[model samples]
Target: MRRAEYHCAAHHPRDWVEDTGAEVAFSGRSNVGKSSAVNAITGRKGLARTSKTPGRTQQIIFFNLDETRRLVDLPGYGYAKVPVQLQQHWEKTVRRYLEERVSLRALILPVDCRREPTVLDWQLLKWCAASQLPVHVLLTKSDKLGHGKSLQALRQTRESLATMPLVSVQLFSATRNVGVTEARERIVDLLSGQGNGRKPA
Candidate 1:
């Protein structure tokens, strides 16, 4: 089997409707290294912009792959500097895309390995639950923690999210390329309708 080729297609707000057959949504806190992870998975540099400022991605960015699959980089939520009204708008927009977009296959939720789950993370998870969307938590920045600590963090996260059924979790570090291949393979499987060990419910 060969790897898929990914390229940035366009960036637009949630209201902008485009035809993307199958897509995977990347969701996480601000500056949690979501863009870097996408670039690492695709083996392409500068495909997704890295920003120091939280909530820099105020719109949904779509990367089309081989004219078949799409990788969506959603706007980061819970940034303090962004106005409350704008934040609410972003939340609504993102929620709409996740709940309403017919082509979305799954959501990859990234969380800082060193930090515990936050309120916003739980809120997003709840939204996914309500919409019956499959979510896999990617523990980002695992390189920042020791092996034992990383394992502990994963366990804690699993316990925290125990109520959500069929939630998959993995450790990832874009800089060291840890778990990049696994992530890519899983994404491909999901897009190809071979993932989740069963049909999507």
Candidate 2:
């Protein structure tokens, strides 16, 4: 539909946590194309700036939509250059938010199609499983793989994370618009409380 209304709601470091209602979080490894996916989904260039350095998004950035919805871009995990203390702080912050935030509706975990699930991904999934929060796996950059390889990758991912409860697993290519419509519709439906089908875990 219309490009969902968006605006910068708040920027919070590990200290100042601002509460937003019914927010959806985007989480992934460092430079796993989370920002690119955000820009693609919103159809706004630079809405979520792409960074050359991994772990550049060191703070939680919240983008408010129509003053009703919030799209949260969480700091990427497993970035090496950042200091250990900062990394620990981010981990704590993200974990606290995920566990405590009542307005959070879902967590969208983006994984690069070329890479297998990392330990960080497993940890995130484990946290979601413990919390019983809805999780979705978005296999980004699907065009990077051949058709057979892409399907294999998706299957492998599903198999590897068999224990985690995921809402859905979808092939997504922001560059090719492969699953953009379906992803968007699914997300919208979920946000509206319509798509309650428990997707394959």
Candidates in order have lDDT scores of: 0.79, 0.76
lDDT of 2 by residue, 1-201 (tens): 245444543334434335544667899999998888787777776788788789888778776665556678889998888899889888888877887776777788899988987998988788787776677788999999999999998898888777765456888988897787777776665555455522222
- In terms of TM-score, how similar is model 2 to the real structure? 0.87
Give the lowest summed-lDDT range of ten residues in model 2: 192-201
Error of model 2, residue 101, in angstroms: 0.6
Q: Over the stretch 14-112, how does candidate 1's per-residue lDDT look in tens digits?
A: 245364577788998999988888888888767788888888877788777766677888888778999998898878788778767778888888999
Off by over 4 Å in 2: 1-20, 196-201
Best by TM-score: 1
- In candidate 2, position 47 carries an lDDT of 82
Provide TM-scores for the models: 0.88, 0.87
